[model samples]
Target: MAGGAAPPSTARGGYRLSALNDDLLQEIITCLPVKEAARTVVLAKRWRYLWPSAPLFLNDADLPQPARDVVVPRVLAEHRGRFRSINLAYFRLASLDRELPGWPRLLADKRTQRLQLTNRNYLPPNQIGTLPHIPADILRCGSLQNLVLGFLKFPVDLSHGVEIFLPNLRELTLAMVIISGEDLEHLITACTALKTLKLTSLTPKRVHLRSRSLRCALVGLSRVEDFAVVDAPLLERLVLYLPGTGARVKIGYAANLLVLGHLDTRVHQLQIRDMVIKSGLKPNTMASTSTLIPSVKILAVTVNFGVLSELNTLASFLRCFPNIVTLHIESVLHDPSVSASAIEPSGEHHAKFWQEVGPVECLRSHVLEKMAIHEFRGDQDEFEFLKFVAMNAQGLQSLHVVLQEGDTSSSDDKKVNEAREKLQDLRFQTGISGVLLVLPKEGILSTLQKATDLTYNDPFRF
Candidate 1:
């Protein structure tokens, strides 16, 4: 009476997938893609009830489009067990007007722990008249531990204190979410258990950090004039990447702050404690211990080697962190339109500039051990800087030179070999033989999102 003979598992030496217990089967089903997970019901008689019984892990992106409208609602409605996580990033707010109202309540009732809702195909705020705001009730979901929202407007009433509390939330990432500065601050404070926060492409006049639980924060590509850390006792890493015009960074009472940067000399003006870093400030003018932030062991900065003033400014910046052991330098290309005074002479003149720049404290103190130069183009100015660091950073153990990818010059075998040879000569002369590494630019070079990720200690290293 067996249908179509016994399954292959019926053989003496074969194993049966259906033999696994319900709990294990459900867990395995949860690991599959949403659509594939749903298809498990047809595998065997035991799996008929498994898909609906397992906790839901639904991602609209996982399902092929053209039918997401029908599939999403059906799954949400039919699933009998708790909701584990839900990501609805493929639909615009206007298209989900009717269904959106019920989502927050359903997610809350089903105990969803992680939720990401984004508005797809949304235009920039300036180009569009107004964006539809996310349902305010979504903020009331107490079971959420991680939330990522993008291309939507936060509730306008948040600034007026309409009672927002996310006591269990741990990680929050907001990208292109239109919200006022006060509301952003209010929302951040409401999350009493927040640990990691990332904000990108959102303009707030000023961002003031005053959180006790926050550890790592990244703000990138935003038009924020001032980023002030009023008080973050537990904060460790603060990364600011591609900041807009007139951006100023002020650090206040971040006692545990260790990792910082991509501090661009052309854009940002940094102020740590009472010390203000500025051009024309001599690096050798450190008369008091209070002027330096010695606790910072890792630093990343953007420097344009062609700019004479930027190099001088970078020298001053480096002197502020005398104990930094790891340094990351991103060499930006020269802008032909930049003021003539900022552009320095090339070839021999650049070598002369580095020679006269005096001893960088971190390099001479025998504390610097690791350095990575990104976007290396085998230019004279770059070589001059590398030669200075190699010769002066006596304690340097490793130097990583990352050649620019897809660059015609970087692909030239002769030029690359010449660069390698020169770097090898410098290494041998400095007694740091076998410490130089020439690498090509590849992979997903670190992003602000990944940089602020709590898992990595030195996000700027790559």
Candidate 2:
């Protein structure tokens, strides 16, 4: 009776329900609601024990008043074979705690791959009690791949002598929960196989990211002042947004890094924008061309600047990327009162012009060919920035200015045309036939969004 459900009914041309085999029929029961699966008992003797014994998904929060306390453990005691994930609300924890080493112990069993124990009984993301300490048994799970815990005062507080190890966790997401920095560090180091780790909306005392194989790491809106990427040799993509002011991040090493944004860079395809790390005080000139990424072929930056003094930072930034062939700058005007001025190849901080004879190898390199300016406002400062890029690239192929939606009024159109005339006029004399494009935002974003693989033709999308 325990091993087999009643045999499958043979096909009756009159009744189609009789056609499914015992195994197929049992699978259908697993997808049904508990009441519907239980009702299958009345349909035929074959389903008598099937409903209660089917792989269960029980949420103590779903059962009404009195049943919440008693029903889960009663059914789980009788449940045999495999189980799909479990959820327990905060209110039921007190009753369930009495049965702890009995019911909570099931969560540690090898078959449960995903486990979440939180307070859906309280409120949206947090509630009115001490956050639960993760069971020591659940922490030692060798087969658990994804674990999520919510609204705990602290995520985990391992008992003094307990040995907690999660050898196979791949994706771990913790929200609105506090954990001591040392304990959190131990939890991450123990996972060994973690690929994606996201820590959101919690202020830990210290954060030391020392992972060798992490691929995608996102630390959002962190306030931690002492943060360091001690070592992450295999880390490829990272987004670190420390929205809190006065936080300085130090990147020790990410040698194989690619596609880093906002968090700061390690190499090749680098983007620096308004989103890039800010020094809180005025930004000093970007570090030297040698200390910065020497292998970078494309450099993108977002700066909030307005005056001639600020425009100088653009040249200083460009000087650091000698191997750059593609450059992207998004104008973010931080001060409206400040004005603009003409660019000088001989300015104090400006590097040698692309055409100037200089000791530096980049001038002769001819590697800079493409430049894209996004959110072009046609302001005096923005115009001067675009004009400077076109004038400096001796081997320039195309310079694109994608205008913001408001930058296209009738008067704005004339200014845009005036800028275009400068490029065309210079092209005849210089003989560097780089195409100058002033595009509307929608056309380009739509093209890139529609294609994921670099199948689209937009140079910026590359």
Candidate 3:
């Protein structure tokens, strides 16, 4: 038969692919997504069963109930190998509730390492599809390393006798989910090996995280009133994006909290105890005894560019994190459509603030390796901020300034150019090895001839 004519399926593009061994065919199929890989069945007889037989990554989330009932079960039944993953983005929630009790059993048996049950159904604004009880057996999926469930609300309090057995769950992301404070803590505690936890838009009054193995956490845009790190010894990287919330973050108990990225604008108290920041006098926010940042070396903070004209707050902050080696200042550009706030003329203090001063009291003679300011519009605020950094940061090897967008005429270009000239013109140059001006969106606003001068020659030398 091979010597004569090929099968109808392999008569055209099929034969070339079928010529490869099973491993090669599977390698090719693995590169394609689940649906596309399944579509390969029509190519050749060898593939008809191969797609169903391979370690399944079935994504029949969009299929209708009638078709899914037949196709999903049929493929699942025929497949002999364990499933690699399953993504159920869209499905009949009511029907899944009525049936699909064995969903957990199937996932546990198939060894689903990653599962994403994201519901993208069209719904009203601010409305999330509540998830029914996750089959308790699913928690038994010890091999499941990553879990993503969006637009879901658990029926009951997970803390009330609910014991999670997912021992290997390393990363868990829950968005638009209704979980209470105690329940969230309980769920986090359940995942014995959980390292990274991200919660977005979750309505929890208080979230107490106490995990020995927790490393990184991102809590964003949530209605969390109080967030305390009860005990996360291994926690290194923590990001809080509480854009518009009155949430307070307390992290004095944590021993090794290093990198913190905070974006919340609310004047919530940030306490880091057992660490002396400023010795004598303190920033107004410092309620307790002043202690410098104990372990934090990298800090990323978001600031409204319009309000940065005064460097008093930033100066006070740098005093707290005196050992900050790499500082990322992300400027939140205000919409010009929004009416600009009327600025009162500078006061007597303003004259003193603007005058060429010695190194900032906090940054004076300190080894600030690099200062990166995003959205560096050369306005009164940014100009003053840049002058303060350039004059204060003694060991500043590189000054990386990312200019903000401007009136389509490349004000990014204009601002970058002007700022560069101003920095060079500044009489104060302590550790000023180089002055760089760049566009935040674009990399740099320099010429082909002088781009090297703006780029960092040795960022890691320190």
lDDT of each: 0.79, 0.55, 0.62
Better candidate by TM-score, 2 or 3: 3
| Candidate 3's TM-score | 0.78
Q: Candidate 1's residue-wise lDDT over 26-93, tens digit each?
A: 99999998899988888767688998989999989897778787788778877998999898888655
Off by over 4 Å in 3: 1-21, 42-45, 61-70, 97-99, 125-133, 263-266, 274-290, 305-313, 333-362, 406-416, 431-462
Pairing residues by index, what is the TM-score of model 2? 0.62
Task: Report the CA-based lDDT of candidate 2 relative to the real structure.
Answer: 0.55
| Candidate 1 TM-score, true structure as reference | 0.88
Task: Show the colliding residue pairs in model 2.
Answer: 131-152, 131-153, 272-300, 272-301, 272-302, 273-302, 274-302
Sum up the clashes in candidate 3: 7
TM-score of each model, paired residue for residue: 0.88, 0.62, 0.78
In candidate 2, position 38 carries an lDDT of: 54
> After superposing candidate 2, which stretches have Cα over 4 Å from the reference?
1-78, 87-95, 98-102, 118-129, 155-162, 263-290, 293-302, 307-384, 388-462
The model with the greater lDDT, 2 or 3, is 3
Residue-pair clashes per prediction, in order, are 0, 7, 7
lDDT of 3 by residue, 244-345 (tens): 445666675666776766533223345555432221132233422354555776676665534423233444455556666677776555434545553323
- Summing lDDT over every window of 10 consecutive residues in candidate 2, give the lowest-scoring window: 265-274
